[model samples]
Target: MMLDADQRRTFAALADVLIPASGPMPSATAAGVPDALLDQALGYRPDLAELFAEAVARCTGKDPEAALDTLAAQQPEQFQALTLLTAGAYFLSPRTKAALAYDPPPRSALDDVDSYIDMLSTVVDRGFAIR
Candidate 1:
């Protein structure tokens, strides 16, 4: 899942475009969206890595916004998937969270029984239950 230097630069460039710096908020790369983080975020979907790399390649030497627009028009699913992965990775950073004034609630041991039951009912209704 390691990215080479070129891939890393491409990812950084893409991330900066996706979450650009604004006022006090840092860009995605500035928020620590490195290749390692991207590797972990996208590891479960190796195909996405290749797709992103190809997309970024097409974006090389082009305006970031225009490149992204082209990618969105040409590969909407891949664009969405990559955008989600990049944003997820960026926001996972403590700096990004703090910048956004988001303080996630602490994990609790208690489970939501109603939600669990509702999920089970939905699964059963969809005929996914093991008979």
Candidate 2:
């Protein structure tokens, strides 16, 4: 997933908070749980993996879980921004409009989130540092 095992739960909690299901779509937590996606990205998208890793390292130093907690505590705004960034990545995927098994809300069959996530993921995967 996007986070390590321990980080998974924390990330999930954060995801749920940051991008909750509103009316018709799943929360970013469910939508962006990147087990396979993360694996693929880490292996295939070296740039993204490195960029994201840098962020993790900056926060946690080594532990992904600690990184998230630290990021939230030390840099709440950055943490929130990261959460939205991840959500955007998942939203931009082609499956946004596709029916989900456990659909949430706020979003309907608009295929909007899919696109958002896809684009966001691409932008950050390359490890672009935003100042």
Candidate 3:
């Protein structure tokens, strides 16, 4: 589930429109949204591959902004897939994450059994019921 060269080019164009450079942030293409980063994103969410491909195909040879507007208006699902994949791929870039200061440290899960004791008791008392 990978984009062909033309599809990748179209996707890059559309992605740049959606996520252009701003302040310290790079545009989507600058962040590799259409290359390895995009491949990583598609690997992570394979469900989006088909719809994302359709979006790229639909927008081919059209004005990126106008195509996005039309897709958003007339084919919302495809637009959503395109936007999600574009943003997801852009954010997947190490450079993009660094620019946004979005490094999230791993945190250990907290044990909060005491806080849910009352709710757990109520549910336990109700027991399981089959319709």
Candidate 4:
């Protein structure tokens, strides 16, 4: 689901407040939190789409910081949705990832079953103690 222009502006404004530039880090907007990255983030978390949309709509035309404060205080669920999506999207940017020195873990699974065999055997020895 694409955000409308106003929603995009509002989201950008709010995201900047939530994740302003830090020492070595860029702000949310600089990291593309409200642009293509946002779409990618929503794609990763489709379950949060509705809540995120509602959050943007609710904050539209309001002062970004004040709106965030209100949402955090009086509408915690929406606030959580907004912050999660914003941060999620911010991290999706290559620039952001590089700035944070993020390294994605290997996709291949390691077969470590043998490493825990002794623990498994102990559990088996205990047997099933049904209450």
Please report, in order, the local distance difference test score of every candidate based on alpha carbons. 0.78, 0.56, 0.89, 0.90
Query: Candidate 4 at 51: error in angstroms?
Result: 1.1
Q: Write the per-residue lDDT of candidate 4 for residues 18-126, one digit (tens) a residue.
A: 9999988999999888889999988999999998888888899999999999888988888998999998888788888789787788886877788699888988999
lDDT of 1: 0.78
Question: What TM-score number comes out for model 3?
Answer: 0.84
Error of 4 at 9 (Å): 0.8
Sorting all predicted structures by lDDT, with the top scorer first, yields 4, 3, 1, 2
Query: 1-131 in candidate 3: lDDT tens per residue?
Result: 86789888898889989999999999998888899988898898999888888888999999999999999998899999989988888878888988988658988699788979988898889998887
TM-score of each: 0.71, 0.42, 0.84, 0.84
Residue-by-residue lDDT tens digits, candidate 1, 1-131: 56778767776887898899998788888888865567777775676777666776777777778888898999887687768778878867778788889667999998899999998998788985567
The TM-score between candidate 2 and the true structure equals 0.42
Instruction: Choose the strongest candidate by lDDT.
Output: 4
The 10-residue segment of model 2 with minimum total lDDT is: 33-42
TM-score of 4: 0.84
lDDT of 3: 0.89
lDDT of 2 by residue, 1-131 (tens): 25567555544555555566766676655565444434443454444554454444465424545667787788665665555456555554444445344456675655678889998998888897768
Which segments of candidate 4 are over 4 A away from where they belong?
Answer: 102-112, 128-131
Clashing pairs in 3: none
For TM-score, candidate 1 versus 4, the one ahead is 4
